[model samples]
Target: MLSAAATPAQLSAQAASGEAGLERSERAAEEQQADNIIVTGRAQKLYRVETTASTKLPTEPLLSSQNVSVITSELIQDQGARDAQDIYRNISGVSFFSYAGVTARGFRQEEIFFDGLRGDPYAGFSVPQLFNLDRVEFLKGPSGMLYGPGAPGGLFNYVTKKPQDKPFSADVRGIVGNADRIGGSAEVNSSLGGGFAARGGLFYEDRGLFRFNAASRTLIADGGVSWSPGPVTVILQATRYDQELDASRLRGVPTDDDGNFLADRRWNHNEPGDFLNLRSDVLQARIEAEPLPGLTLDATMRYNDATEVQNYHEPRGLFDSDGDGIRDATIREFRDQRRDEESWSFGGNAVYAFDLGGDVGNRVLAGFDHFNGEEIFAGRSLRGRNRVVAGLPSPLSLLDPVYGQSDPATYNQGPFSIFNTDSRRTGFYLLNELTVGPVIITGGIRQDNFHDDSDGIVFEDEATTYRGGIVYRVTDEISLFGHYATSFEPQDPSVQNPLAGGPFAPTAGDIFEGGIKTALMGGRIQSSLSAYQIRRRNILQVDPRGDVGNDGVDDFVAFGEVTSKGIEFDLAADITPDWVLTVAYAHNDTKITGDNGGGGILNRVGDRFANAPKHQLGIWTRYQIPDIGIAAAFGGDYVSEQVSLSGQPVRPFMIFDTSLIYEVGPIRAMLRVDNLFDKTYAVSGFIDRTGHFPGEPRSIFLEVGYAF
Candidate 1:
């Protein structure tokens, strides 16, 4: 460990970060100097330093990256960010937009990583607790180059927290707040044997939110081991998570005045949704070695599997045209749905660095990576065998008040399947980084070979991608850069044969961006501003009825085009030795530059994409009083109205949160208030009786912990 002798520049930086108070600032500086390598915001020689946010670029940055955000462990802890949704919502250019749902962005489809290894996508969404996480990296672009196929929105990588050599330490906390909620988390770090260390973390939370009726229970456990021998190091990790939720909503009779949602009574109840019960398991292993002084190699593999069950009621009379309320035209009031999915990924990369021979002060670094992924998704629905009239006297509605009635229908006895799908993909890449004096340039080429073979049908194709970037250090205080990148997304399995009996082909897009990075106040304060333009062609849009029905067969076609231009700003500073503040904001103009919506060729064309908010902003602040052993944090987010898939407006919303902490000896206590302002917001839901999904309401949690 390095000693506590800080440089004058370091001291000045700390002073500026703590501009909120001089005494606190100076004291913080003294403490930082005492803890070398802790406050520098730079890692030791063991690894290169990466700025956690795209706004702040470290000396050595990821090549050809338009924008990236790194959420460090330090920041997560200080701000008490609970999950991936919290991280994304607090960042600019992003919104939760119904992040609470299982199929939403951060919850289900987002790409993720553990350490440097690829993780199973099916299990990514099931990760309810963030235990043993070192950092969360958000690469804001199509990461098909390094990672594999995913959303065009971006990708998220979770760096697992590793074992430290500092003997042993532990922390325990308890939280309580809104909707009769309570939760806690515990972590332990220790050393085992010859060059071996281990760490484990466990978390549990239960809470009910302010909705017509909704509640959740979650439990997660994660552990990892690190082994180093000679010039090689290996790390292994595993995690298990389980969750159950009572998801209540009105499916039809769905809209209220102003096109809002009142409730659906189709299934004999005021609120008739379903119960979501899920369980997931994941395992990952990674190895890194140095064959030579300046050469390194990395390899990783991961697997994940999960199961889900949903129980809901479907009213046949609601949508059935003949509309008879009795047995002749009746539909079952109870349905059982189950889904299972598995994912596996593997990849390897080699990086070499060498000095250029001369006074040019230049160096060259190069690497290559390959990755593959596979998935299986299945869903089944079952109906009961009883029936009840609206005015009938039956206990089915009274016994299970949520669904109202559960008696099986007379005819559709066994089960009726709705949807099922399976897919697999392979990706590979080559990348290079060059540095000369104060300028660095990077270039990369990647190819993706994706094949979608579903239930005897096969769709296969390949595409190549390229990226380039240049960064110049104008001065120690300012850095300027520009970047260009491309992405390719294939058509969905639901695409049908319009002519000749073949599926519609995939589409592509390109993005261009430019930005400036600055470190002021001796590096204590960091700020970044960026502008970008994205153009997409041959886009696919779903039809009405929320399905791609091609005469009972799903149908799809390449639409026209779309363009989005936006500006993003992020700022972070140590306002005082005791206070840290962060701010992020984004403004975007997204429109269908060209389309065939008039011809019914596109449904989403000319309609703002679902979940894309025009504006988003967030702020967070924290302060600590060492002498008093007290600390506090405040933060929240605001988002503008969003356009739904049907061209309807989802109202804008805002939320606030705060927390307080006190320490005594080795034990620490914390009290947190979520949705502090009790803002009535809907993270995800439909308007005009589409069925509203209310966001989490005001809640509180009190936790206790001990650090050994």
Candidate 2:
């Protein structure tokens, strides 16, 4: 949903998000300094993004020597994408891992930031809906140099929609779809005079699920105010999110290594009275100042309060008590949980631009950030034994399950854990970029000190990470780049297992990447091809030496390593003024290079990471008919076969999606069909004992909206 041109209001929004930079030329930079809003009225790719805020450097993505992808609000609305899961198919080398978790570049990635700053959007399980969002930016590979400790694969940053100077505008929409789906949303934006603007949006949905007695409901509301009274700008915003899932989280359906389910596709053991619910409230503020030409400063602060309550029934395992070689029932356990958390963070940065004589230009940036969070949890201590209710249907039947059975034993729980956790981190970072002739050099370093306390047990560590990259423009339309980066994450300290050894060491990651980027067809086409190798060390692995701890449990050791290398290609093209196309493909080969007792004959070494597909492709195109206000879009996503954690083969899948749209001055309607062919495939493989996750079936949705 990118655009070729925008008004000055849009320019201000970009600067507030830290995405405004020297994209085209020196003149653009001068104009931006003079008015703090650059004019890019010239022709540009409609679906291509030139810059991102993830790097924290005033450089464009084409010259940054890194891989970053942008999903704009336009694209999201046109494709009828509701959440991050629906949009994952459009990104390269990204796949679903678990609840709100993704497999990125051969590793599990769940880290999310808001407006380029590390903060939780909606904590635990539920993913945030794409309402009141300007865009979603993804940075591939380790970002420890700027963001701090994280998984090596990559991270996601969601940019919030900001108030803009524009005529009064309002929109309202209603949605209807299969599976008893119904929803509605409304948004309003206007200039309130006195150098002030305000925007607000609200969304609500209630949808039915395939699982019996399982349904979902979500509500989100956000409002923000922006003021630009002279050389400084300030923004304040607040958001509230509430969601509830009718049952405990599903693990997967019971299946074999070949992904053939043994039970009904909708098989579930959750009781009718079980539930999982979450509530979160956030307050955010940002300020930007341009006290002098060529020098800019910005600061951000956020405070969050959240709570979660869950009470559900869990399936222990299939029980074949009849000894007839058939697992007809499951042992059940009742669990109750309550969690309350509060978090706050502050970040500020200063950027200075100056000339080093000649045609050389340089920009130096310095930043400091701090974060603190605390959580208190009280949950059932035991999982299966003491928590297991003894009564009719407590050990639910898998074949002919009966519900509405009451178990008095579960009315009162036995043992419980009242755990309190506190975590704090502070970081200082510096970045310098130099542009000379057709060559650009970028380097950054960050030092972070983190402390964590869990029920009186404390762990503290400090780490310094580095990043360096270079981009050489071969011509005005082609460029070559190379990058190197490192990452670090401290392992939460734990008591030495009697047999698994002492507290584990921190995990480390590094990557080497090179690529070529091209913009052709007079700015109508943009493309990039890159290859990279990433290595992760000191990962935890199940101890293969047998349970030496003698505590009746499997042990783990910090002696695992993995390597991921891949090639990625992405392109966005505007064939004509009315037609647009986008394609992304990736090939990744991930292997475990080191492990604990990895196979002597048949082991974990050389095995691909779970849920990591070797090949992935996504293509989307939209064509609008001239003067008719009609547009049609067709898209497909293909993912190669992947292995599950239980060594099961998740068959490859190709899903086609189509949408028809009709738009007039103030009214619009869209009909979208997903999984057009109704392919039955597994979304992901979860556990050894459970079944693989099932993919959604064919669905059709119709939406109507009006603009005033």
Write one digit per residue (lDDT tens) for candidate 2, span 437-471.
88998999999999888787777778899999998
- The 10 consecutive residues of candidate 2 with the worst lDDT sum are 4-13
Pairs that collide in candidate 2 are 1-74, 1-75, 253-691, 599-603
Question: Top model by TM-score, which number?
Answer: 2
What TM-score does prediction 1 earn? 0.81
* Cα lDDT, all candidates: 0.57, 0.76
lDDT of 1 by residue, 418-503 (tens): 44455666666776667777677867777778777655566788888777788777665567778787777777654544432346
Q: After superposition, how far is residue 248 of candidate 2 from its true place, in Å?
A: 3.5
The per-candidate count of clashes, in order, stands at 34, 4
- lDDT (Cα) of model 2: 0.76
- Which structure among the candidates has the greatest lDDT? 2
Cα lDDT, model 2, residue 255: 72
Worst 10 residues of 1 by lDDT: 1-10
Q: List the candidate 2 regions with Cα displacement exceeding 4 Å.
A: 1-46, 321-324, 381-393, 397-401, 406-410, 495-501, 541-557, 598-606
